[model samples]
Target: MRYALMTLIAVSLAGCTRAPAPVADVVAVVSASLPSDPADAAWNAAPEHVAKLLLQDLVEPRLQAVSTPDVRVRAFTAGQEIALRLEWPDATINDLPAAGRFNDACAVQVPLKPAAAVPDPQMGMAGNGVAISFWRADWQATVKGRGDTIREIYPNALIDHYPFDAPSLEKGSAAQQKMATEYAPAEGAGNRRGGARTTAVEDLIAEGPGTLHPAPAAISRGSGVRTPTGWAVVITRPLPDGLSPTSPSQIAFAVWEGSKQESGARKMRTGWIPISIREDQP
Candidate 1:
Protein backbone atom coordinates (compact mmCIF):
# COMPACT_ATOMS: atom_id res chain seq x y z
CA MET A 1 0.00 0.00 0.00
CA ARG A 2 2.85 2.39 0.82
CA TYR A 3 4.61 1.51 -2.47
CA ALA A 4 1.31 2.16 -4.36
CA LEU A 5 0.94 5.56 -2.64
CA MET A 6 4.51 6.50 -3.55
CA THR A 7 3.93 5.50 -7.16
CA LEU A 8 0.76 7.61 -7.32
CA ILE A 9 2.59 10.65 -5.92
CA ALA A 10 5.45 10.14 -8.37
CA VAL A 11 3.07 9.92 -11.29
CA SER A 12 1.29 13.10 -10.18
CA LEU A 13 4.63 14.91 -9.82
CA ALA A 14 5.69 13.72 -13.29
CA GLY A 15 2.49 15.10 -14.77
CA CYS A 16 3.07 18.44 -13.05
CA THR A 17 6.67 18.61 -14.35
CA ARG A 18 5.89 17.62 -17.95
CA ALA A 19 7.55 19.85 -20.47
CA PRO A 20 5.38 22.34 -22.31
CA ALA A 21 4.82 22.04 -26.04
CA PRO A 22 7.64 23.34 -28.14
CA VAL A 23 7.07 26.82 -29.56
CA ALA A 24 8.30 27.70 -33.01
CA ASP A 25 9.51 31.28 -32.91
CA VAL A 26 10.13 33.52 -35.89
CA VAL A 27 13.50 34.72 -34.70
CA ALA A 28 14.53 38.16 -35.90
CA VAL A 29 18.23 38.58 -36.42
CA VAL A 30 19.85 41.91 -35.61
CA SER A 31 20.64 44.08 -38.60
CA ALA A 32 21.97 47.56 -39.19
CA SER A 33 18.94 48.53 -41.24
CA LEU A 34 15.65 47.01 -42.34
CA PRO A 35 15.31 46.01 -45.96
CA SER A 36 12.33 47.38 -47.92
CA ASP A 37 12.93 45.25 -50.97
CA PRO A 38 11.76 41.70 -51.01
CA ALA A 39 14.69 40.50 -53.06
CA ASP A 40 17.42 41.99 -50.86
CA ALA A 41 20.12 39.50 -49.97
CA ALA A 42 20.06 40.60 -46.32
CA TRP A 43 17.05 38.36 -45.80
CA ASN A 44 19.29 35.36 -46.22
CA ALA A 45 20.74 35.87 -42.74
CA ALA A 46 17.34 35.44 -41.12
CA PRO A 47 15.87 32.05 -40.41
CA GLU A 48 12.72 31.04 -42.25
CA HIS A 49 9.57 29.75 -40.59
CA VAL A 50 6.75 28.12 -42.47
CA ALA A 51 3.41 29.04 -40.93
CA LYS A 52 0.42 26.89 -41.81
CA LEU A 53 -2.73 28.76 -42.76
CA LEU A 54 -6.33 27.93 -42.01
CA LEU A 55 -9.45 29.07 -43.79
CA GLN A 56 -11.30 31.87 -42.05
CA ASP A 57 -14.78 30.54 -41.43
CA LEU A 58 -15.64 31.94 -38.01
CA VAL A 59 -17.85 34.76 -39.31
CA GLU A 60 -19.94 35.76 -42.27
CA PRO A 61 -18.15 36.44 -45.53
CA ARG A 62 -15.79 33.66 -44.59
CA LEU A 63 -13.44 31.83 -46.92
CA GLN A 64 -15.16 28.62 -47.98
CA ALA A 65 -11.99 27.00 -49.31
CA VAL A 66 -8.26 27.10 -48.87
CA SER A 67 -6.14 28.50 -51.66
CA THR A 68 -2.92 29.43 -49.89
CA PRO A 69 -1.87 26.65 -47.58
CA ASP A 70 1.14 28.30 -45.95
CA VAL A 71 3.53 31.24 -45.93
CA ARG A 72 7.31 31.26 -45.52
CA VAL A 73 8.43 34.04 -43.17
CA ARG A 74 11.81 35.57 -42.31
CA ALA A 75 12.47 38.57 -40.11
CA PHE A 76 15.18 41.02 -39.13
CA THR A 77 15.43 44.02 -36.83
CA ALA A 78 17.34 47.32 -36.90
CA GLY A 79 16.84 48.19 -33.24
CA GLN A 80 13.88 50.55 -33.71
CA GLU A 81 12.26 48.77 -36.60
CA ILE A 82 11.70 45.26 -37.94
CA ALA A 83 11.04 43.74 -41.35
CA LEU A 84 9.40 40.50 -42.30
CA ARG A 85 9.79 38.82 -45.67
CA LEU A 86 6.98 36.51 -46.67
CA GLU A 87 6.92 34.11 -49.58
CA TRP A 88 4.11 31.89 -50.79
CA PRO A 89 3.36 29.91 -53.92
CA ASP A 90 1.11 31.66 -56.43
CA ALA A 91 0.87 30.74 -60.08
CA THR A 92 -0.76 33.96 -61.30
CA ILE A 93 -0.22 37.64 -60.67
CA ASN A 94 -3.17 39.93 -59.92
CA ASP A 95 -2.24 43.51 -59.20
CA LEU A 96 -4.93 45.51 -60.96
CA PRO A 97 -8.22 46.20 -59.19
CA ALA A 98 -11.38 46.34 -61.29
CA ALA A 99 -15.00 45.38 -61.09
CA GLY A 100 -15.11 41.68 -60.11
CA ARG A 101 -11.30 41.66 -59.90
CA PHE A 102 -9.44 41.51 -56.60
CA ASN A 103 -5.83 42.25 -55.70
CA ASP A 104 -3.45 39.79 -54.08
CA ALA A 105 -2.46 40.97 -50.62
CA CYS A 106 -0.92 39.98 -47.29
CA ALA A 107 -0.96 41.45 -43.81
CA VAL A 108 0.88 41.16 -40.49
CA GLN A 109 -0.99 41.61 -37.26
CA VAL A 110 0.55 42.36 -33.84
CA PRO A 111 -0.99 43.37 -30.60
CA LEU A 112 -0.96 47.06 -29.76
CA LYS A 113 0.25 46.12 -26.29
CA PRO A 114 2.31 43.03 -25.65
CA ALA A 115 1.22 40.94 -22.71
CA ALA A 116 1.19 37.42 -21.42
CA ALA A 117 -2.20 36.96 -23.01
CA VAL A 118 -2.72 38.11 -26.59
CA PRO A 119 -5.82 39.45 -28.20
CA ASP A 120 -7.90 37.31 -30.50
CA PRO A 121 -6.02 36.52 -33.68
CA GLN A 122 -9.12 37.40 -35.72
CA MET A 123 -8.33 41.11 -35.41
CA GLY A 124 -8.87 41.60 -31.65
CA MET A 125 -11.32 41.84 -28.81
CA ALA A 126 -13.28 44.92 -27.65
CA GLY A 127 -10.65 46.71 -25.60
CA ASN A 128 -7.65 44.89 -26.97
CA GLY A 129 -6.53 46.11 -30.38
CA VAL A 130 -4.09 44.91 -32.99
CA ALA A 131 -1.99 46.88 -35.42
CA ILE A 132 -1.88 45.57 -38.95
CA SER A 133 0.53 46.36 -41.76
CA PHE A 134 -1.11 45.44 -45.03
CA TRP A 135 0.67 45.06 -48.37
CA ARG A 136 -1.10 44.70 -51.71
CA ALA A 137 0.40 43.69 -55.02
CA ASP A 138 -1.55 46.47 -56.75
CA TRP A 139 -0.20 49.05 -54.33
CA GLN A 140 3.28 47.76 -54.92
CA ALA A 141 2.76 48.16 -58.65
CA THR A 142 1.49 51.68 -58.12
CA VAL A 143 4.50 52.54 -55.99
CA LYS A 144 6.74 51.08 -58.66
CA GLY A 145 5.46 53.72 -61.16
CA ARG A 146 2.26 52.20 -62.45
CA GLY A 147 -0.09 55.08 -63.14
CA ASP A 148 -3.41 55.03 -61.29
CA THR A 149 -5.28 56.71 -64.11
CA ILE A 150 -8.10 54.80 -65.75
CA ARG A 151 -6.34 55.04 -69.10
CA GLU A 152 -3.30 53.34 -67.61
CA ILE A 153 -5.28 50.63 -65.87
CA TYR A 154 -7.39 49.92 -68.93
CA PRO A 155 -5.31 50.87 -71.95
CA ASN A 156 -8.02 49.68 -74.32
CA ALA A 157 -10.82 51.47 -72.55
CA LEU A 158 -12.68 54.16 -74.48
CA ILE A 159 -13.94 57.22 -72.68
CA ASP A 160 -16.34 60.01 -73.61
CA HIS A 161 -15.52 63.66 -72.93
CA TYR A 162 -14.90 64.50 -69.28
CA PRO A 163 -16.57 67.67 -67.94
CA PHE A 164 -13.36 68.70 -66.19
CA ASP A 165 -11.55 68.40 -69.53
CA ALA A 166 -13.97 70.78 -71.26
CA PRO A 167 -12.19 73.47 -73.28
CA SER A 168 -14.05 76.31 -71.56
CA LEU A 169 -12.67 75.50 -68.10
CA GLU A 170 -9.08 76.72 -67.64
CA LYS A 171 -6.64 74.07 -66.40
CA GLY A 172 -6.07 74.16 -62.58
CA SER A 173 -8.98 76.55 -62.19
CA ALA A 174 -11.32 76.12 -59.18
CA ALA A 175 -14.26 75.27 -61.44
CA GLN A 176 -12.23 72.69 -63.31
CA GLN A 177 -10.92 71.25 -60.07
CA LYS A 178 -14.44 71.08 -58.68
CA MET A 179 -15.64 69.28 -61.77
CA ALA A 180 -12.74 66.87 -61.54
CA THR A 181 -13.46 66.32 -57.87
CA GLU A 182 -17.09 65.65 -58.73
CA TYR A 183 -16.02 62.98 -61.16
CA ALA A 184 -13.59 61.40 -58.66
CA PRO A 185 -15.77 61.53 -55.60
CA ALA A 186 -13.66 59.03 -53.69
CA GLU A 187 -10.54 61.10 -54.20
CA GLY A 188 -12.45 64.23 -53.31
CA ALA A 189 -13.57 62.60 -50.06
CA GLY A 190 -9.85 62.11 -49.12
CA ASN A 191 -9.92 58.36 -49.57
CA ARG A 192 -6.30 57.35 -49.78
CA ARG A 193 -7.02 54.23 -51.78
CA GLY A 194 -8.74 56.29 -54.48
CA GLY A 195 -5.73 58.51 -55.23
CA ALA A 196 -2.11 58.01 -56.07
CA ARG A 197 -0.15 56.39 -53.25
CA THR A 198 3.52 56.93 -52.57
CA THR A 199 3.84 53.81 -50.44
CA ALA A 200 2.76 50.24 -51.02
CA VAL A 201 1.67 49.59 -47.45
CA GLU A 202 -1.05 50.83 -45.09
CA ASP A 203 -1.13 50.70 -41.30
CA LEU A 204 -4.46 49.73 -39.84
CA ILE A 205 -5.96 49.06 -36.40
CA ALA A 206 -8.77 46.79 -35.44
CA GLU A 207 -10.81 45.77 -32.43
CA GLY A 208 -13.04 42.77 -32.84
CA PRO A 209 -14.58 41.59 -36.13
CA GLY A 210 -15.92 44.75 -37.81
CA THR A 211 -13.97 47.56 -36.20
CA LEU A 212 -11.07 47.98 -38.56
CA HIS A 213 -9.88 51.53 -39.34
CA PRO A 214 -6.83 53.24 -40.69
CA ALA A 215 -4.13 53.94 -38.19
CA PRO A 216 -3.70 57.66 -37.47
CA ALA A 217 -0.05 57.53 -38.39
CA ALA A 218 1.14 55.71 -41.48
CA ILE A 219 4.65 54.52 -40.71
CA SER A 220 4.97 51.12 -42.37
CA ARG A 221 6.52 50.40 -45.77
CA GLY A 222 6.71 47.31 -47.93
CA SER A 223 7.62 45.91 -51.33
CA GLY A 224 6.44 42.88 -53.28
CA VAL A 225 7.78 41.16 -56.37
CA ARG A 226 6.74 38.23 -58.48
CA THR A 227 8.97 35.18 -58.32
CA PRO A 228 9.10 32.47 -60.93
CA THR A 229 6.76 30.35 -58.87
CA GLY A 230 5.18 32.75 -56.39
CA TRP A 231 5.17 36.19 -54.79
CA ALA A 232 7.78 37.45 -52.31
CA VAL A 233 7.06 40.43 -50.10
CA VAL A 234 8.90 42.45 -47.45
CA ILE A 235 7.04 44.46 -44.84
CA THR A 236 8.98 46.86 -42.60
CA ARG A 237 7.46 48.60 -39.60
CA PRO A 238 8.25 49.94 -36.15
CA LEU A 239 8.84 47.23 -33.60
CA PRO A 240 6.03 46.45 -31.22
CA ASP A 241 6.17 48.44 -27.94
CA GLY A 242 7.52 45.63 -25.79
CA LEU A 243 9.69 43.65 -28.18
CA SER A 244 13.31 43.39 -27.21
CA PRO A 245 16.37 41.29 -27.73
CA THR A 246 15.60 39.08 -24.78
CA SER A 247 11.83 39.40 -24.82
CA PRO A 248 9.43 37.62 -27.13
CA SER A 249 6.09 38.64 -28.61
CA GLN A 250 3.44 37.28 -30.96
CA ILE A 251 2.35 37.87 -34.55
CA ALA A 252 -0.36 36.68 -36.90
CA PHE A 253 -0.72 36.64 -40.66
CA ALA A 254 -3.44 36.81 -43.30
CA VAL A 255 -3.22 36.25 -47.04
CA TRP A 256 -5.60 37.03 -49.88
CA GLU A 257 -5.46 35.37 -53.27
CA GLY A 258 -7.13 37.57 -55.83
CA SER A 259 -7.13 34.77 -58.34
CA LYS A 260 -9.32 32.78 -55.98
CA GLN A 261 -11.70 35.71 -55.33
CA GLU A 262 -10.30 36.19 -51.83
CA SER A 263 -10.73 39.64 -50.33
CA GLY A 264 -11.68 41.41 -47.11
CA ALA A 265 -12.68 38.64 -44.71
CA ARG A 266 -12.57 35.89 -47.29
CA LYS A 267 -8.98 34.82 -46.77
CA MET A 268 -6.54 32.39 -45.11
CA ARG A 269 -5.09 33.25 -41.70
CA THR A 270 -2.82 31.93 -38.95
CA GLY A 271 -3.09 32.14 -35.22
CA TRP A 272 -0.68 34.12 -33.09
CA ILE A 273 2.85 32.78 -33.50
CA PRO A 274 5.79 33.47 -31.23
CA ILE A 275 8.56 35.87 -32.28
CA SER A 276 11.97 36.44 -30.75
CA ILE A 277 14.76 38.92 -31.37
CA ARG A 278 18.35 37.83 -31.13
CA GLU A 279 21.75 39.54 -31.15
CA ASP A 280 23.70 39.74 -34.37
CA GLN A 281 26.31 37.07 -34.89
CA PRO A 282 29.92 38.18 -34.99
Candidate 2:
Protein backbone atom coordinates (compact mmCIF):
# COMPACT_ATOMS: atom_id res chain seq x y z
CA MET A 1 0.00 0.00 0.00
CA ARG A 2 2.88 2.42 0.84
CA TYR A 3 4.66 1.70 -2.48
CA ALA A 4 1.48 2.21 -4.47
CA LEU A 5 0.80 5.56 -2.73
CA MET A 6 4.40 6.77 -3.44
CA THR A 7 4.04 5.81 -7.14
CA LEU A 8 0.73 7.64 -7.41
CA ILE A 9 2.24 10.77 -5.84
CA ALA A 10 5.18 10.71 -8.31
CA VAL A 11 2.82 10.40 -11.29
CA SER A 12 0.70 13.32 -10.11
CA LEU A 13 3.76 15.53 -9.65
CA ALA A 14 5.03 14.70 -13.17
CA GLY A 15 1.66 15.55 -14.69
CA CYS A 16 1.61 18.95 -13.01
CA THR A 17 5.10 19.95 -14.22
CA ARG A 18 5.12 22.86 -16.65
CA ALA A 19 6.46 22.52 -20.17
CA PRO A 20 9.19 24.76 -21.59
CA ALA A 21 8.18 27.61 -23.87
CA PRO A 22 8.38 26.80 -27.57
CA VAL A 23 10.94 28.77 -29.58
CA ALA A 24 9.47 30.97 -32.30
CA ASP A 25 10.78 30.25 -35.79
CA VAL A 26 10.79 32.83 -38.59
CA VAL A 27 10.82 30.55 -41.59
CA ALA A 28 11.78 32.23 -44.88
CA VAL A 29 9.75 31.10 -47.86
CA VAL A 30 11.49 30.87 -51.20
CA SER A 31 10.35 33.30 -53.84
CA ALA A 32 11.42 34.30 -57.33
CA SER A 33 11.68 37.96 -56.39
CA LEU A 34 11.72 39.79 -53.10
CA PRO A 35 8.80 42.10 -52.44
CA SER A 36 9.55 45.73 -51.70
CA ASP A 37 6.01 46.61 -50.74
CA PRO A 38 4.86 45.72 -47.24
CA ALA A 39 1.43 44.70 -48.44
CA ASP A 40 2.47 42.79 -51.53
CA ALA A 41 0.30 39.73 -52.05
CA ALA A 42 3.44 37.60 -52.38
CA TRP A 43 3.98 37.93 -48.63
CA ASN A 44 0.78 36.03 -47.97
CA ALA A 45 2.51 32.75 -48.77
CA ALA A 46 5.02 33.16 -45.92
CA PRO A 47 4.20 32.09 -42.39
CA GLU A 48 3.95 34.68 -39.63
CA HIS A 49 5.86 34.51 -36.35
CA VAL A 50 4.95 36.62 -33.36
CA ALA A 51 8.03 37.82 -31.53
CA LYS A 52 7.27 39.01 -28.01
CA LEU A 53 9.05 42.24 -27.17
CA LEU A 54 10.69 43.24 -23.92
CA LEU A 55 11.57 46.59 -22.41
CA GLN A 56 15.12 47.79 -23.00
CA ASP A 57 15.93 48.41 -19.35
CA LEU A 58 19.47 47.08 -19.36
CA VAL A 59 21.12 50.44 -20.15
CA GLU A 60 20.60 54.10 -19.45
CA PRO A 61 17.87 55.92 -21.41
CA ARG A 62 15.90 52.70 -21.29
CA LEU A 63 12.23 51.94 -21.85
CA GLN A 64 10.59 51.75 -18.43
CA ALA A 65 7.39 50.13 -19.72
CA VAL A 66 6.29 48.01 -22.63
CA SER A 67 4.66 50.13 -25.30
CA THR A 68 4.63 47.51 -28.08
CA PRO A 69 4.06 44.06 -26.69
CA ASP A 70 5.01 42.15 -29.84
CA VAL A 71 5.71 42.27 -33.58
CA ARG A 72 4.58 39.97 -36.44
CA VAL A 73 7.49 38.96 -38.66
CA ARG A 74 7.64 37.26 -42.08
CA ALA A 75 10.61 36.46 -44.25
CA PHE A 76 11.22 35.71 -47.94
CA THR A 77 14.36 34.83 -49.88
CA ALA A 78 15.30 34.97 -53.57
CA GLY A 79 18.76 33.81 -54.54
CA GLN A 80 21.20 35.73 -52.30
CA GLU A 81 18.76 38.37 -51.13
CA ILE A 82 16.45 38.17 -48.15
CA ALA A 83 13.55 40.33 -47.06
CA LEU A 84 11.69 40.61 -43.77
CA ARG A 85 8.27 42.12 -43.23
CA LEU A 86 7.43 43.41 -39.73
CA GLU A 87 3.92 44.32 -38.69
CA TRP A 88 2.87 45.82 -35.38
CA PRO A 89 0.02 47.82 -33.90
CA ASP A 90 0.20 51.59 -33.37
CA ALA A 91 -2.97 53.62 -33.06
CA THR A 92 -1.42 56.84 -34.33
CA ILE A 93 0.67 57.74 -37.36
CA ASN A 94 3.73 59.71 -36.31
CA ASP A 95 5.84 60.56 -39.38
CA LEU A 96 6.68 64.22 -39.12
CA PRO A 97 10.04 65.07 -37.53
CA ALA A 98 10.59 67.97 -35.13
CA ALA A 99 12.42 68.92 -31.99
CA GLY A 100 11.42 66.66 -29.06
CA ARG A 101 9.54 64.45 -31.53
CA PHE A 102 10.54 61.05 -32.89
CA ASN A 103 9.22 58.95 -35.77
CA ASP A 104 7.89 55.41 -35.53
CA ALA A 105 10.46 52.88 -36.69
CA CYS A 106 11.52 49.22 -36.73
CA ALA A 107 14.82 47.41 -37.22
CA VAL A 108 16.00 43.87 -37.98
CA GLN A 109 19.37 42.68 -36.67
CA VAL A 110 21.47 39.68 -37.72
CA PRO A 111 24.84 38.51 -36.50
CA LEU A 112 27.92 38.70 -38.71
CA LYS A 113 29.31 35.43 -37.44
CA PRO A 114 28.11 31.91 -38.23
CA ALA A 115 25.02 30.44 -36.59
CA ALA A 116 27.16 28.14 -34.46
CA ALA A 117 28.57 31.23 -32.69
CA VAL A 118 25.77 33.78 -32.37
CA PRO A 119 26.47 37.16 -30.86
CA ASP A 120 24.64 38.91 -28.04
CA PRO A 121 21.30 40.23 -29.33
CA GLN A 122 21.81 43.60 -27.60
CA MET A 123 23.49 44.95 -30.74
CA GLY A 124 26.17 42.27 -30.35
CA MET A 125 29.52 42.36 -28.48
CA ALA A 126 32.79 44.17 -29.24
CA GLY A 127 34.24 41.70 -31.72
CA ASN A 128 30.99 40.03 -32.78
CA GLY A 129 29.28 42.73 -34.80
CA VAL A 130 25.73 42.81 -36.17
CA ALA A 131 24.14 44.20 -39.30
CA ILE A 132 21.00 46.26 -38.86
CA SER A 133 18.36 47.11 -41.45
CA PHE A 134 16.26 49.98 -40.14
CA TRP A 135 12.99 51.31 -41.57
CA ARG A 136 11.38 54.56 -40.44
CA ALA A 137 7.83 55.74 -41.02
CA ASP A 138 8.94 59.31 -41.70
CA TRP A 139 11.40 58.13 -44.31
CA GLN A 140 8.67 56.03 -45.83
CA ALA A 141 6.44 59.05 -46.05
CA THR A 142 9.13 60.90 -47.95
CA VAL A 143 9.58 57.98 -50.33
CA LYS A 144 5.81 57.83 -50.83
CA GLY A 145 5.80 61.41 -52.29
CA ARG A 146 5.43 63.36 -49.05
CA GLY A 147 7.50 66.53 -49.08
CA ASP A 148 10.16 66.99 -46.39
CA THR A 149 10.27 70.76 -46.64
CA ILE A 150 9.61 72.86 -43.55
CA ARG A 151 6.54 74.33 -45.24
CA GLU A 152 5.16 70.85 -45.82
CA ILE A 153 5.84 69.82 -42.25
CA TYR A 154 4.49 73.07 -40.75
CA PRO A 155 2.15 74.81 -43.16
CA ASN A 156 0.95 77.50 -40.77
CA ALA A 157 4.39 78.53 -39.54
CA LEU A 158 5.74 81.75 -41.04
CA ILE A 159 9.06 81.62 -42.87
CA ASP A 160 11.39 84.14 -44.47
CA HIS A 161 13.01 83.71 -47.88
CA TYR A 162 15.39 80.80 -48.30
CA PRO A 163 18.68 81.46 -50.08
CA PHE A 164 18.32 78.29 -52.10
CA ASP A 165 15.03 79.55 -53.51
CA ALA A 166 16.37 82.95 -54.60
CA PRO A 167 15.29 83.60 -58.21
CA SER A 168 18.12 85.99 -59.12
CA LEU A 169 20.73 83.19 -58.86
CA GLU A 170 21.07 80.74 -61.78
CA LYS A 171 19.55 77.31 -61.11
CA GLY A 172 22.95 75.51 -61.10
CA SER A 173 25.23 78.44 -60.44
CA ALA A 174 28.07 78.01 -57.90
CA ALA A 175 26.94 81.09 -55.98
CA GLN A 176 23.41 79.65 -55.64
CA GLN A 177 24.80 76.26 -54.58
CA LYS A 178 27.03 77.89 -52.00
CA MET A 179 24.08 79.80 -50.50
CA ALA A 180 22.00 76.59 -50.43
CA THR A 181 24.83 74.74 -48.66
CA GLU A 182 25.11 77.55 -46.12
CA TYR A 183 21.39 77.28 -45.29
CA ALA A 184 21.45 73.46 -45.07
CA PRO A 185 24.74 72.62 -43.43
CA ALA A 186 23.73 69.08 -42.56
CA GLU A 187 22.94 68.26 -46.19
CA GLY A 188 26.13 70.04 -47.28
CA ALA A 189 28.13 67.87 -44.89
CA GLY A 190 26.69 64.73 -46.56
CA ASN A 191 24.68 63.80 -43.46
CA ARG A 192 22.02 61.21 -44.27
CA ARG A 193 19.37 62.92 -42.15
CA GLY A 194 19.13 66.15 -44.16
CA GLY A 195 19.60 64.80 -47.67
CA ALA A 196 16.84 63.56 -49.97
CA ARG A 197 16.33 59.86 -49.38
CA THR A 198 15.62 57.44 -52.21
CA THR A 199 14.58 54.62 -49.95
CA ALA A 200 12.98 54.13 -46.54
CA VAL A 201 15.51 51.63 -45.26
CA GLU A 202 19.04 52.35 -44.00
CA ASP A 203 21.76 49.75 -43.53
CA LEU A 204 23.77 50.10 -40.32
CA ILE A 205 26.33 48.25 -38.25
CA ALA A 206 26.89 48.00 -34.52
CA GLU A 207 29.34 46.22 -32.27
CA GLY A 208 27.43 46.97 -29.11
CA PRO A 209 25.37 49.67 -27.46
CA GLY A 210 26.20 53.33 -28.33
CA THR A 211 28.12 52.18 -31.40
CA LEU A 212 25.52 52.23 -34.17
CA HIS A 213 26.64 53.86 -37.41
CA PRO A 214 25.83 53.82 -41.13
CA ALA A 215 27.28 50.97 -43.08
CA PRO A 216 30.09 51.63 -45.57
CA ALA A 217 27.65 50.86 -48.38
CA ALA A 218 23.88 51.09 -48.37
CA ILE A 219 22.77 47.77 -49.88
CA SER A 220 19.28 47.57 -48.42
CA ARG A 221 15.85 48.63 -49.68
CA GLY A 222 12.46 48.74 -47.95
CA SER A 223 9.02 50.34 -47.74
CA GLY A 224 6.49 50.95 -44.95
CA VAL A 225 2.74 51.43 -45.21
CA ARG A 226 0.39 52.85 -42.61
CA THR A 227 -2.44 50.38 -42.13
CA PRO A 228 -5.72 51.12 -40.43
CA THR A 229 -4.44 49.64 -37.19
CA GLY A 230 -0.69 50.34 -37.40
CA TRP A 231 2.40 50.10 -39.61
CA ALA A 232 3.61 47.28 -41.86
CA VAL A 233 7.19 47.49 -43.11
CA VAL A 234 9.29 45.41 -45.48
CA ILE A 235 13.09 45.52 -45.28
CA THR A 236 15.25 43.70 -47.82
CA ARG A 237 19.01 43.20 -47.96
CA PRO A 238 21.72 40.82 -49.11
CA LEU A 239 21.62 37.54 -47.24
CA PRO A 240 24.11 37.26 -44.38
CA ASP A 241 27.38 35.33 -44.82
CA GLY A 242 26.35 31.87 -43.68
CA LEU A 243 22.54 31.55 -43.99
CA SER A 244 21.44 28.73 -46.30
CA PRO A 245 18.46 26.53 -47.03
CA THR A 246 19.67 23.91 -44.58
CA SER A 247 21.63 26.21 -42.27
CA PRO A 248 19.47 28.05 -39.76
CA SER A 249 20.16 31.46 -38.16
CA GLN A 250 18.78 33.98 -35.71
CA ILE A 251 17.25 37.46 -35.79
CA ALA A 252 16.30 40.23 -33.35
CA PHE A 253 13.88 43.13 -33.53
CA ALA A 254 13.36 46.62 -32.09
CA VAL A 255 10.39 48.94 -32.44
CA TRP A 256 10.12 52.64 -31.57
CA GLU A 257 6.78 54.25 -30.90
CA GLY A 258 7.10 57.95 -31.61
CA SER A 259 3.93 58.89 -29.80
CA LYS A 260 5.20 57.22 -26.64
CA GLN A 261 8.51 59.15 -26.90
CA GLU A 262 10.38 55.98 -27.76
CA SER A 263 13.76 56.60 -29.39
CA GLY A 264 17.34 55.46 -29.21
CA ALA A 265 17.41 52.89 -26.41
CA ARG A 266 13.94 53.81 -25.20
CA LYS A 267 12.02 51.18 -27.22
CA MET A 268 10.64 47.67 -27.08
CA ARG A 269 13.04 44.96 -28.26
CA THR A 270 13.38 41.21 -28.60
CA GLY A 271 16.16 38.75 -27.94
CA TRP A 272 17.43 36.35 -30.59
CA ILE A 273 14.72 34.37 -32.39
CA PRO A 274 15.50 31.31 -34.46
CA ILE A 275 15.09 31.58 -38.28
CA SER A 276 15.48 29.13 -41.13
CA ILE A 277 15.45 29.31 -44.91
CA ARG A 278 13.37 27.03 -47.13
CA GLU A 279 14.35 25.46 -50.42
CA ASP A 280 13.30 27.04 -53.70
CA GLN A 281 10.17 25.63 -55.29
CA PRO A 282 8.75 25.60 -58.80
Q: Number of the top candidate by TM-score?
A: 1
Q: Which tens-of-lDDT digit does each residue in 1-282 have in candidate 2?
A: 999999999999887634222235888878888988887877767778889999987789888878999999888899999999899999988888888888999999999778467888888878999999988888888887887678767889787887687889998789997888888878777776844578888889998999998899998898888888899999899888788888888889999999998988998999999888977421
Highest lDDT: which candidate? 1
TM-score of each: 0.88, 0.87
Q: Which stretches of candidate 2 lie over 4 Å from their true place?
A: 1-23, 280-282
Alpha-carbon shift of residue 203 in model 2 (angstroms): 0.6
Each model's lDDT comes to 0.87, 0.85
Candidate 1 TM-score to native: 0.88
Ten residues in sequence with the least summed lDDT for candidate 1: 16-25
Sequence-dependent TM-score of model 2: 0.87
Estimate the Cα RMSD of every predicted model relative to the unseen true structure.
12.1, 10.1
Native-structure RMSD, model 1: 12.1
Per-model clash counts, in order, read: 0, 0
